[model samples]
Target: MAGARVTTGSRLGVRIREVPVPADLDAPDAWLLRGQVDTVNEVEIALRGNRDMCRNPHETLGSMREQRYTTKIRLVAVDEDRPGDAADPARVLGHAALHLPRQDNTHTGEVDLGVRPAARRRGIGSALHDAALEVARVHGRTMLTTTTQQTSEPTDGPLALAPSTGSGRLHRDDPGVRFALTRGWSLEQVSRYSVLDVPLPADVLAAHRAAAQAVAGPDVRVVLWESRCPDEWVDQFALLQTRMSTDVPHGGIARHADVWDAARVRTIEQQFLDQGLGYLVAAAEHVPTRTLVAFTALAATPVTDEFVFQNDTLVMREHRGRRLGMLVKTANLQRLAAERPAVQRVGTWNAEENAHMLAINVALGFRPAGGTGEWQRDL
Candidate 1:
């Protein structure tokens, strides 16, 4: 139960309260969760011209239950006068989530904050940020990281702010960008958001896969699976995941290697299943060694047929020269098209500095859709 509410400066009578996670979507307080889903979807649509990133209420609740290095706290800004029901889209003026990693990087916290378009300039966002900051301080977190989305790269000028990486820029006037800058946050890195319209010509996918296989040589083979990892390959998959933590480009964002093991991998897979989401994984196996060397994954919810998210793509250091990245990615894309034909578009994010992977994406027909800035602040 949410115990207390603090009113903000907005004349809309907006109040901030900690939302309690319900046992299940059917719980009475589930209305709060539904309101959160509505608020997030509206915000994404307003910013990106689409709601492809929105999670359904069930998926939102499931994320709260994840115990793998994550403890989630959500705060919602609600209008006192127009406290609408579960069906109301604008009931929640804005919301913020603080994710505290328990196993590692305890000194750091991740924040996700958003406000409805019509409700901006009303102090709702500031109230939520203040509430999140206080909670983070109480938990002993010294650093905070958040992300802002931009639909286009900002040109070199007074209104554009370049990240420390110097590879991408964001408009200084974007509400999220301005909010973070005013709060002492610094731009750390920028990630390019790309989208690929799926169901590529069968011949195109086959040719790409064939070319990658030839470059990878006869010593490596691709293995595909849906939902859970096969018991035989789970441990090797875990090792690839651990490598994924440190192998990627992280710019100036403070982060530690996320340790992963067989058990942890299974836990994450189960979480995805419980959330009513389906995922596809394609791993490159070195035939001689009989071990998984590289992997990539894609996930989608049944809620929408138009969008799917390309989660992670990593090739082990020693395995890099052989084009395993292209092999696993092309293999998975083919599988995704066959298994989830309704998914018309695949969305993915890559660090602007990650040239190799971006090149592969470009060849696969993914065009730049937008960019996201990873911002950090030390408390």
Candidate 2:
């Protein structure tokens, strides 16, 4: 592998191949690896080309898994000829990627590319893109999509993101965005980040609690679940996963079967528990029927800023105006506040046009911090 990568940065003997599981050594001077791994060695290096933690290598990796496809492409560009002796041996020169999945109706998730300052606009970015598009077409899928931070700074510079840990900041002029635009990808969906500058104020929280209490009634019970909850709920969690698409505005829709499964639910539940966080779910119990309507859930993991990650707040068509969204969010927020009181601020991203969820967030006092436009190219 070292012999293959020995080259000068001015010219790369680039090679792109779809070698699965065990990667191939003779594949290329420049390379990409795909699939789930217990380790990422350093994807963060490619994501944090900005000052703010706008690019999430962790979340991006999760997206690939959540979509039940390996939308993950790991690129390695090194001076193959110079590998044996340099101040920093095997110094990666360029990194760009996209995840491709057949189950996603041939959908692909393109990511921002990061390049070392010594190499830019020299066709490396174009080559990465060409590789992504080829995958989309070969898989019999029609669309390829990705997101980038909307910024006014220069986007073709020498910034980099640390790998794995979702903490490094990306520069506004990071080369990833520049490569995305230059390659002809256009806006698809816009994802915005909301930051709670202050806490979810006292009085407003009181009023929200009252609202949930006022309407939750005796039949609908809101509950918080930690690892201690009965494992039998995995079936219910699996069902809830199918309802996730009720409100999100992402471009390519994931198949219900791909997102819902008892085993997958158990894995996610365990992951939350292992991380010392749980989720809030609202269920309506009808004593007469002996069944529960699993309506919504809000889950979060404690990161540097205490992310109040919210997902899947679904209401049956018959229950829409009943404020179930507010009920679920309020329950989760109160639970987190009471339990993990150290958690100060909450943040979430909503489609610019998802008024229902937006209304709920605004009512809960989540304010907009930034927005990202989802771009797609039809193959």
lDDT of 2 at 62: 39
Candidate 1's TM-score reads 0.95
Q: lDDT of each structure?
A: 0.87, 0.51
Q: How many collisions per candidate?
A: 0, 28
1-379 per-residue lDDT for model 2 (tens digits): 1112223356665443332322232334212332112112233323333222332333333333343334455554543344553323134555545565434344444544544544555565566556556655656657667666543222233553221222222343445555555777654455556656335666777789678656756666665565433455566656555556443455432322345567767666654554444465555433344344444554554334444556566665555666666776776666666766666666566665567878788877777665555666667
User: For residue 260, what is the lDDT in candidate 2?
Assistant: 56
RMSD list, candidates in order: 1.8, 8.2
Off by over 4 Å in 1: 1-5, 8-10, 83-90
Candidate 1 residues 1-379, lDDT tens each? Answer: 2424655553676667777788887877777777777888888888877768877888888877886668888888877788446435367788898999887789998999998889888778888898888889989999999999989887799998888999888999987898999999999999999999988998998899899999999999999999999999999988888887799998899999888889988998888888888889999999999999999999897678789999989998887888888889989988887888888999999999999999999999999999899999998
| Model 1, backbone clash pairs (residues 3+ apart or across chains), number | 0
TM-score of each: 0.95, 0.66
- Report the error of model 2 at residue 271, Å: 5.3
Q: How many steric clashes does model 2 contain?
A: 28
User: Best candidate per TM-score, number?
Assistant: 1
* Candidate 2 Cα misplacement greater than 4 A, ranges: 1-72, 79-90, 100-123, 136-140, 151-182, 227-229, 251-259, 270-305
